[model samples]
Target: MDYSFTTIGALIGMAVAIILIIKKVQPAYSLILGALIGGVIGSGNLILTVDTMVSGAQSMISSVLRIMTSGILAGTLIKTGAAEKIAEVIVQKLGEKRALIAVAAATMVICAVGVFVDISVITVAPIALAIGKKAGYNKASLLLAMIGGGKAGNIISPNPNTIAVSEAFQVDLTSLMIKNIIPAVCALIVTVIIATILSKKAGTMVSDQDLEKHADNKKLPTFIQAFAGPLTVIILLALRPIFSIVIDPLIALPLGGLVCAIACGSLVQFREFAEFGLSKVAGVSILLIGTGTIAGIIKASALQYDVISLLEMMKMPAFILAPIAGILMAGATASTTAGSTIASQTFAQTLLNAGIPAISAGAMIHAGSTVIDSLPHGSFFHATGGSVGMNIKERMKLIPFEACIGLTSTIVAVIVYLI
Candidate 1:
């Protein structure tokens, strides 16, 4: 039922999807169309094609649910004023002179609490911009700083990309999260340093002056109330690593949201906050399903066999190939979740079959997915770049720095895998 005509069929299907995505079609719709074409061509059997696509989608149901609930936790973190409070404290302690580090650190923390990377950038933009202005740093530097931090945090956080890869590889969520921390920290440090260097050379870049500003007078939550929810999530999720307890992210993310709702006294507005978070990831959740369909088609195709054969011919290790697969796919899709999802579903099994450890391979692939997940075709490129008034040329500047940060984690993961 799989691996026969996959090479040509999956190639054609993926080509169609990439073209549609480039033409500004919604990724979900584009991917769905890709699946239909790929399915029919790969198997020439309508019933088998439908079954394969459905099976692939069904494979992602558990992960998708976790992603949706993460929206609840991420939403509550923002709605409760915790995200801002955390950012403000970090920037204040570091002082304006260290604004680049301060902003990147704050963003890393905010995103560590399961906030999507694009939203994390948007959330940190105001503070980053203000501090950059005070410190004579350009908008591009600040934007890059925030983005680099986001890329760093995303691999370790219980974000959709993390969830998809973890589920695909059958690794424990907490174990996967815990295993990635050191690599994330290393990547973050590199990201901040690069961004700081970029600031020195900013020279005559566009300013943030024309960007519209908004005001809010809502009472800020006390520091304890603000920090409590995220801290609890981290603690509960860490038990598996620290003490061998097995709390799944699905359990931890919603529980953290509930705590945030209660501690921030936003329990009354719980529904609204949850809705807000879901709204942000609504497109992403659908995109995950769409990627799943493509993943299914590929699974039934011979594309994987060809790729593995090439790797073997080059005497490449599966661990190294794993990350490359992730980087390329995510780069192609311009979305981490989709990239990691497809990479894991299509290649993780192959890697495992080649004797790579699931958790290690999963960790490497997860980091690799973040490396180029923000390409121009995806919403992340426009949404994040547009948020800070970046035109196409300006936005392109951030890609290399962002990739380096993610690549740092991926390299560290490869080392860990080898060890």
Candidate 2:
């Protein structure tokens, strides 16, 4: 892993890209530029830049597809009014003094569902918003609640990312969860408690008039009715894989998404379905492409390989590396799911192949992913911020403490795993 001009350039480019993203520049474009600059720095030749960028683009295929599928499915849920129905039911249940806790709990539940479904923004936030308005608190509280819940689940839930990482690292889900769930739970509890205290101390109360004005007044479908669609898709997706036992995620993803769409009554004849699907494709595709491209870039640069090498070189104790890597990657990626998934699947797997303990590797990977997942720049935080209307700065104040619970949980899990 000697440093080359290309390596130095890539590092600088990455820094620039991060700064741009922080400045609110378009992520896709920023990432692309970063890749280009990194390539140029590494090779020091104009001709190499084109090839490097293409290499980066090529690498993103899988990630892009995953994100695209998730986005479109999410969009379809929103457009079809399925998400709304679910959110409505959640709001009705969050009815009084313990309103904050209700929102937190509901958000967590919805996020857990989102892990399998993969459209957390649409899946978790609408319910949070409805509940927040009902309880007369700012949308930020509700939004953060949803975010914390979803973030916890994103790392802990049955996401392909989680599964992929676990399997790659030679660990089981049960082992990882046993060690990680407590921290995730604590983070969420803290988030709700903080919101509740703030709401009360600030004397935030929604008047009857305001509540009535905000109320939809439309009768929603029953929870069973609403849950039926997603539930069906989940079962089928589960079965589809076991049934085939050789299916790829790309095909399976759309299959599950389509099924969910149909279950939610999206089958409004071929022509209408075609039209709606077409309308949504652009946004969804962009999101997918962006993430994929970034993933591709990482792959192409052999960062995963390099990271694994670095980890091997560390020669640190299992207890130490797991939390350190998890925290660093989570902070770097702004996604526990992404950070943990990548590190686990890449670095941790490499370590396991090198004969590290499976449970230790598993616990560490989970620890790394969850701790960073709580950061302000993380995707979950951004989605929560958008849902609640808070800027990153405001979110920073509360989110870190919640995330710490996850970090602490991860550390404890590692210690226990080591023992």
Q: Which candidate leads the pack in TM-score? A: 1
The number of clashing residue pairs in model 1 is: 3
Candidate 2: residue pairs that collide: 6-42, 59-296, 60-292, 60-296, 64-288, 64-292, 326-368, 334-378
- Candidate achieving the largest lDDT: 1
What lDDT would candidate 2 get against the real structure?
Answer: 0.54
| Candidate 2 lDDT by residue in tens digits, 332-399 | 65655445544554355445655767766766677566655655543556655554455677667766
Tell me how many residue pairs clash in candidate 2.
8
Residue lDDT tens for model 1, 207-247: 55633362356677877888888888899988988799888
- How does each model score on lDDT? 0.84, 0.54
State how far residue 416 of model 2 sits from its true place (Å): 7.4
**Candidate 2 at 166: error in angstroms?**
8.0
Reference-based TM-score, model 2: 0.71
Q: How far is 239's C-alpha from truth in model 1 (Å)?
A: 2.4
